[model samples]
Target: MLQDARSVASRSSQEAEIAGPASPEFIDFDRLLAAVRRQWRLVAVLGLIGLLLGIAYVMTAVPRYTASSNLLIDQGSNRIVDELSTSGGSIEDESGILSQVELLKSDQIGNKVIDALHLTSDESFMHSSVSLLRRVKLAVVSVVDISSWFRAPEEEADDEAEKRLTALALLGNDLDVARVGRSYVLSISYTSPDPVMAARVAQAFANAYLADQLDSKYEATRRASSWLQQRIDELRQKSLETDLAVQRFRAEKGLIAADGRLVSDQQLTELNSQLTLAQADVATARAKMDRIQSLLESGDTNSVVNDALASTVINELRTKYLDAAKRQAEISNRLGNDHAQAVRLRAEMENYKQLMFSELGRIAESYRSDLQVAQAREAAVQRSVADATSVSAGANETQVQLRELEREAETYRNLYQTFLQRYQEAVQQQSFPITEARVITDAQVPTAPSKPRKPLVLAISLFIGLAAGSALGAFREFRDRFFRTGDQVREELGLAYLGSVPHVKDKALAIPTQKAGTGTEASDRYLRANNAVARYVLDHPLSSFAETLRSAKIAADLAISHQKKIIGVISVLPSEGKSMISANLAELIASHGSSAILIDGDIRNPGLTRAVARHATAGLLEAVMDERPLKDCILVDPETKLALVPAVVKHRVPHTADLLSSVNMTTLLDEASNAFDYVVLDLPPLGPVVDVRAIAPRIDAFIFVVEWGKTARRVVRSTLAANPQIAEKTLGVILNKVDTEKMKLYRDFGSDEYYTSRYSSYYHQGK
Candidate 1:
């Protein structure tokens, strides 16, 4: 029979393990939502803290006003000179506009503004709020003399230099330069504690920038003019010397040519021109002659060749040939091929055509004659040019030297003239230089501060706080190693989750069944509340808690069949409500019309004994020691009619474990098993002592009780590991003190309509 109960308990444990709550290893959105919902107070508190911080910042922060001055940079061309044109077209390139922005922020303009405004002496400008910390640090450095450890530090700068550097730094920090989109416009903004000062500085920056541009242009022009002036004087002197040298050499050697050109120079020029014309004439005549000759050979008549046939004899021959051909055509049209008149006309026309051929040959000969004359003229001009070149070569070496000197003189003269022209332009530009950039919009007095954007800061703070709070909540949830759900027990510890017992509010109602009519009003109220909770199986049998208890009962029945009814209830830690489970389980078995005995096996803390038999002097210990009869130690509850063996001893037992494993105790359990259909022992917490281990072998199976969301996994695992025999006897773990309302937060856990109680109001509709 005991073997059968063990088999049933083992089978029940396995089934419970399989049918536990869903594990968190899978996606569980409901669990995450529940976690956030449960920790909302923390989120709200953190958000409030962030909001307060934002408010403090707004209250304590200094208001800074930003005044912007927009300047339109006409980058198309330099106003001073078109020679200094830029590649900037209608639209400015990214780099071009960015460079303009950089120019606006440059130190040159910064220094100019500083000097113009005399800001170097302004305390706020020299030591703005932005560098207050730095100023304090400098003050400290000036006072401290910690040069003993290291080499002596360098001496500080004079007040003027320090003030200048501080102003520069402050100016840089206060200035903001940005391009206005893709346009050739720049926005120069200045920030200051004083609104009017900000506006003044911004406007001054634009003015200073424009003035700097004009000054630079004028300076460049002045420098150019100075260089040109010096260069022009040098060039003029050099030109005069070259001219004098040329004239002296020409006079000394008489190598100067009239009209600034030698006879050979004129001859070469005239020869080259005539040679070109002669060559062109020869080519034209040759081409015409070739055309006439080709026409004569092919027997083709053309007007161009008629020029070669300009002879009177040829003209008469051509006219006679045409008259003869006309008469032949007239006769051929009037008579047949065999007619006498047509034959005579044909003979006459043939004779005339032969004469015309002779005349054409004469014209071709004339064209050849003209081509020869052109070639002769070309050769004559060539000879004249050669003679002229030879005559010029006979001139002395001084002539070449004179030419070189003249060329040098002319070159210097041109350079001097060019420099003189540029110098005049430069002087004119220096007098009035134009700036490329202009102020599109002047800086206006700022009406408000740009810093301390309250709403934006508050919004950012809220987001950060929310993120931090959520992270903290998640961290806490992750750090917790307890069994938050029955699935944790099943998945992590590989233990079966028998069932969960909802947290009972009224402990008095959870008391073991006592004698009827002996209960007071307080006890009745406690009983009612308990009936709705821990004792739900008796009063609210159809409730979720009751259903959970019945499930556990079913599992116990499976693990321990009718033949083996001796079961032990234990937990890993105290306050797990194992005693209550044991007592209730006993009552459940008794209500099934089976005799069930409940025993308090925990001698150290006799919870069951205190609840069932408060005034009893002797119980398990005395019965085990044979100091009292076993029947005298057993108490029968009148309400449940279940037999109870409470551990109500007057004095503590030194060797409680030894007493529990004694032969008398074993015999007592054996007799109780025989007398009752079911025996339940409320054992000590498994984690706190080894008493449970000693009794583990005596009991058929154990109902391992654990407080839901409270029992640490490490404690349960370590306790079970330390006592392998007890672990083996454990039928399954019972999760006590479950928050059912909280469980509904996880959609998957309590989505069932039955658990939600769709008709919950039906029970109290008439009550």
Candidate 2:
């Protein structure tokens, strides 16, 4: 009992948290269990469907084949090799090889590969990877230029190479090329329907690069050979003259085998290039240097503009005007020349553009006009350089003119020195020319194609199908909650199951009339639905059903040995299950040989006529309204073990609950209770005209009927709550028509109860 109470409380608390205050009270646990039980079939079907779909997907999906090849990249010059150069070649190169990876992936090399592979004639190779993300960095600008192949179908040639190109263009989309680690190797992988083709394509790319590199080296050698030949002739004359001039100078200065300026010719060339760039940069950085130095020296908090005649604002405005003019001209081209709007825009654009260029020239000239300032900046730098110690010649420009001949001779002398070293290396290079880059391994034609995985597709398809089925099953459950489970009667209306009868299998439906032509044995099968429901209530009396009242009375009777309780029946809504409750309970209870009285309390709308007939000319309405004796109003039956009191209303002035709850009605019930084992009150449903509330407090127990999905929860709650006496003493709720297809869905155990219903029996037997 404690456990049951705890479970109920916990469940109610959970419901409150989930559904807030609007949640309907909990129904009978057995009914919910039954509903879930009934839906087990749907769950099974949907689950099976999901499983089958998954299996089907596993079967039909295409398998993708993969082919991979590698390329080793010699990323940068050997750093250690350069350090070990005791031969005195050049300074140590400090830059790492990682930065050189980007340079290798630059457009020049990529274009070379593209041209060599003839990708310009095949567009498919350009989109080597998906947009936004790639397996390797793209050398092209965001998009691969595949315009050559896709130019036009008409442009495609009829040759076999062109045909292969077409197919290659299509298939190349599956191929991916990227540089291998830091070595001089590259990895090319491709997925295709045919594995051999994938491998062949990858190998083709490698061969193409090798061929391109050889061609490039040969061209460089040719250019170098031509350049060296020209220098050889030019230096012949300069070499002889330099020797003569040196000898003459030597005689005049009385000097012997002296040092020459040719010692740093290479260094002088590098310094000259650097100086030229520095001069151009110096022009721009002077104003900046002055501003920065002034701030550093003066420690100023605010900036001071130095040039009063500065034309930056004007120059900037002019630049914008030029851009706008260009845009206007471009737009004008898209239109006609003689168009008035176009002509006006073009004129305005040209005028602005000219103004901008003129303004920039004017600005440059203004700066040049300040020659004194430029000279002053140059002089400061010159002073700084003068203080710096010199290691090379040509440090100052003032030492010139007569030194040109000397410079020429020195250049020739440096060339001779380089030739002497090259001559020595060339001898060794020929003897010990090692080939480290010979092919380590050759690629082979792959035996598989890597693509079209149908299994993955089928798997996804299966998931979609099962998900669709499961969703549909869930929706099917929401249509009806009444006949769905036994708990419905108890939880929804605070009623109880009387008792449930097993559904008879394949029983012939035969409605024996009042004449009893078929006998009682055959009739039992016809009325199995009503009997089964009554039996169900004996076990589970979750709510206020009269069965709950019966169970309570029966339990209370356990101590007393034999005590019966009188139960009053009512429903919040009219025509829900009040009539069924009276007839079925009376019939089922009497089947056990217990005497039961069915008092039809609805005087205005008597229900006994449709269910059973009793002798009654003047009934309870006349007795209650006119104060007739209790014995005369009630009728006793010996054959069925039941009694009936028909209302004499005949749709006349109704005898209300106020009349029934009077001392007269109470005295009548008291007498009947002593005479019968059980007394059933068929009370009026709650509505505007019925006085059900007035007589509620007078009942020993009451049964409320909620016709499954038909009765509104709000109507029942409101109407019941309005009658506190009835709500408190309510026996429980009974869900009627719970066997309707809608309600039967909640009946986990499939039964043929419908086939043997009284109506079914009556209809089938007649047919």
Candidate 3:
């Protein structure tokens, strides 16, 4: 159990280190709700103030009437003049519509409206009523103008020009022009104090915009026409000059032509065709002549060469030769030996064959003649082709310059035609002027004013006020760093929370002196008058304050299993009522039939001695220094039998911490432990002194006291951390001097303090 308590203490120290002081790692909504409940009055008052201001503004503000006119940027209307006009005729896209919107808001349109309405001369339009917000702004500016005292004299100005400029500026300021969504429709709005004037101004702005568009288009078309006319005249002159140059160059170069082609070119084409035919004829003739010659050389007289020649004499001789050969063969068969008739027939066949050869030679000679004629024709045609080629080549060289001149003439002619057409279109467009913008809805007078929306303004003001109040409340909550309840003590120090002691007022701290009484009664009255808060536990044993001391006593008993326990009661800082708690706790324990001794161990500043035993001359300091008997220096209450060893400060003791840590102090506590059932020591605080740390080893357990809503959580955590032995030995923490009324504000739903009201009747206080 002791090890577990130590571990919890160690873990709590680690958490304190990690979270620092008031770290906002996690938000506790319950705490926030409690804070809101506590500070709701502040938030409500701020919001009410904001609401009143908003109401005053609404009541005093000037109302402005707004009139609207709608314009449709007709992109389709441009199609009527799109083909004829050279200028842009229609709004193309969103950007074009926005451009038109900007044009409507331009100073040119504003000037036109001002002139049309004669706004410069009209007092209502020239000097409208100023708004409350504007008045406040002007007042602030005048007050803050530091240069007004040293400013130089103003120069004379032109009134009329200034009025005109001011009117234009006012018109621009009150005008609102915007394109409606993705469409080519513009909404123009004007605001003024007068309804009729507002409508008139809005309508005038629309008229001015339309007129501007028409005038711009007309001017553009007129300029285009003039430019096109000038270009047409220049192009006509250029066209004539180029045409003349082409004719002069053609004639000078002698590039004569028949039809579309030159004469020399035609002649070359004809000669080339003739050369091709002549070459073909030559090939045919040579082939025939070669065929006949081959037949004659092979001696094949009876071959088809002779037949192909179609000679009557050669055919007759061939027939007669065949008959003779047939007759010779028959005669040789009849006459066995060399027959004379067969020999004679053979000689006749030979003669016929020779005649056929002679005929074939004649045919071959005719073929050779035909071949020579074809060769000569081919040669003549080739020579003519060569001559034509040379002539055509020269004509072609001259045609290059002719082609260049023709191209130049063609270009001028085409340009002249194009300019003439465009000139006609420009003229048409100039005569028929049209604008892409037109009014779709005329401006109408508004029934109500558009300024000073009361409900919305009030709501916004209230919201802002509430937000600011909430911020301030949260800051206050963050700045509240002191402990207010037992939960805070347990969570911050990792010690068990014993209980809370109710705050005792100064009147309650002083007991009324009783009129003369018995010896026992007189002694009790003296003790009570001297320290009523410490003696309060005896009179009100069942009260919450006394119950808290009992709880501490129980915790001390649980922490130390020894029969005699030396428990130290310590606090982080001085004046936290630890001395009173120590005295009360010892008295409460002694009243329970236990022998308890109360010792004022704070030798440096003996607050307990001053409150309880101020008349004592010797104390723990005297006993430790001079080895005095504990009984001689101790003061015992006659009623409760509680003993107290107060430190009597006769002089300044510089080494009180050393004296507390000395062997004599240890021996004194051991001797007291042997006599008393409980040894409670009222030690000095841990913040400004090290006496508690010096004697912490001798203490078996400690009860830490923290003044409610006074001692900082950081101070307690740091003091315990500086003295780990005290933190380890601490049995629990007791909250002293708690304001019970304010304590309810810090309690969450399930905490013990939340149920304090329900259990209040359980304890009674003696008056």
Candidate 4:
């Protein structure tokens, strides 16, 4: 049976460890909701404060009005001077629009606006109404000007210049310029306390921007015209000087030109053409002469002699010779040889051949004459070509310098014409300057203030306040290491949770004072009810405090089946109501007609002795050290018949642990066990002393009492873990001094405590 009880206790501990504290990996929504419920008051209070602050801000804040003006940067507006405009009368791209926006925001435009409006002298523009917050800030800065003391003095600026700069800076601060997305339009806005002033400032900004643009363009054109004039004069002078230099160079080098070409070059070209023709003529005449001479030398006169020298005469002579030869042959055939007529015919043929030869020789002589004339002409042309070549070569060498001078002169002349044209354009542009930017929509006074939005400010303030409150609440929850519910006792210490005991004050349980005439029985009753907490179980048996003790009794009975179970009431820290629990539990057990005894085991402090047996001088100490009988040291309860062996301390007892662990102490408990059905010992807390550990082995079971929301959970777990024997013998834990109403907020939906209110009527409280 003892082994079975031990096994059951061990299994309960193992289950408690398995169902220990919730893992950090997952969020427990029930716990979070419970925390929120507990901290709702704090959150509400902070949110209310934030709402009040927002109301104050809305009431005290200065109203600011914003007026806006729209200006269009027309790309074609400058087309009146398009021929002279350097920007080509067109905005190039997005960058150009952005540049215009920047220009509108520049100090140049800002100063112009300031000067035009005379903001430096206008009191409304120079000094606006300050808000309450700003006043407070200025006051703080004046009070905490520690750096000013250490700063070195500097020279002051001119009054006029300083005023101008200050006005410019103020204008810049109030001015807002932006390009209307992807378009050549600028939006200029100004904020001020006065609506009229805002409109005026906005209009001033637009006017100033347009005026500045016009002034910039006029200045650029004027400077360009002046520079062009100077450049034109220099170019004209240079043109005249270069022209003179070209003429002088040409005369010095004798480079005379004709029809856009040099005279020497033309002469060389004509001589080359004549030389080529003369060579061709010489070749033709030489070929004709050589052909006729070769024909004559070959001596073939009877063959058709075609010569340049009168071919008709040669043809006539040949015909005649042929006729004569025919006659000579006829006669020679008719008459005999040696006839005079036949001989005369043969002589005529000879005469015709000689005349053909003579004619051929004369033709060859004429060919030779033509050849000589062609050769002479070729020679004469060759000489003329050589002379022309010499002249052309000299001219080419001098032309290098001449060409350079010509090029310089041409460059100067071109520059002079170009500058003159540009000067004319610049003059035109200067005469008619135009600005591309113009106000399309003039600024109007705003009907309502633009800042200090009350609703939005209130909402944001509330949100921030709530967020802050939640952060603090979460920090409080994180630091809440104390036990609130019975579940905490079980989960943290791995022990069964019996129940919770209410914190019953003595005034609430008001015990009547004993009269002088009252008997011994009445006095004993008064003494028994002296401590309301210790005697609560007897007076109110139906209360939750009494019920918790009953549950502890049942747990003790189940854990230890001995005839006289020795149950030790223990706590991790002092003042956790362990003595009260021990006294009440013994009284509750004895009220059922079972004999029980309470022992004050804390020899060092002996709180139980002071509570119940205050008049007793000697009790457990006398029983253990003086060897007195336990019955003589015992005090019996008047109502429940519960016995108590109080530890009466006359002086400091240094070896309280040794006395508790001595054989005499064990014998004293043994005697109590034989005489009573149960022995309840109010042992010292496990944290402060070692008395509980020394007497743990002798005890049958222990009922751990923890102060509700007072004792740290880690202290209990660590104390129990340090003494495994005491932990194993522990029957269960009881949460003492619980605030039942507050505990309701900490309960989960499915927990036993969640339904505690439903069954609370079953338990009645006695005054």
Which ranking of candidates, highest lDDT first? 4, 3, 1, 2
Return the TM-score for candidate 2, rounded to 2 decimals. Answer: 0.40
Candidate 3 lDDT over 230-332, as tens digits, reads 8889999999999999889878877778898878888899999999999999999989888888888998865766345577888788889899988888998
Model 1 error, position 390 (Å)? 44
Task: List runs of model 4 lying over 4 Å from the truth.
Answer: 1-27, 71-110, 135-154, 158-187, 211-438, 512-526
For model 4, give the 10-residue run with minimal summed lDDT. 520-529
- Per-residue lDDT tens digits for candidate 2, residues 187-244, read 5566644455456555655555555544544453444445545655666666888877
In model 3, where is the ten-residue run with the lowest total lDDT? 520-529
> Per-residue lDDT tens digits of candidate 4, residues 1-767?
34534554564457656878545748888888999999998888888888888889899888889999999987766544445545564566887788888888888888888778888888766667444555576568657977756666574456787677657766766678888777778899998899999999899889988888787788878877787788888999999999999899888888889899999999999999999999999999988887787888887765433463348888788789889988998999999547999888888889998888788888889889999999999999999999999989989989988889889999999989877887776776677788887889999999999878888999988987888888888888899999898667656776778889988787776663423326764454334446667777777888989888888888777767677899899998999999889888998999989999889999998898888778776699999999998877877776667888888899899998999999999999899999999999999989989999999889988888999989989888888889988887877888999888788889987676888989999899863
* True lDDT of residue 327, candidate 1: 74
- Please give the RMSD to the true structure for each candidate, in Å: 12.8, 30.8, 8.5, 13.0
For candidate 3, give the lDDT.
Answer: 0.82
Backbone clash pairs for candidate 3 read none
Write one digit per residue (lDDT tens) for candidate 1, span 407-514: 999999998898788777777767777778899899999897898788998888888887878788778778767766655665565666666666767643433343
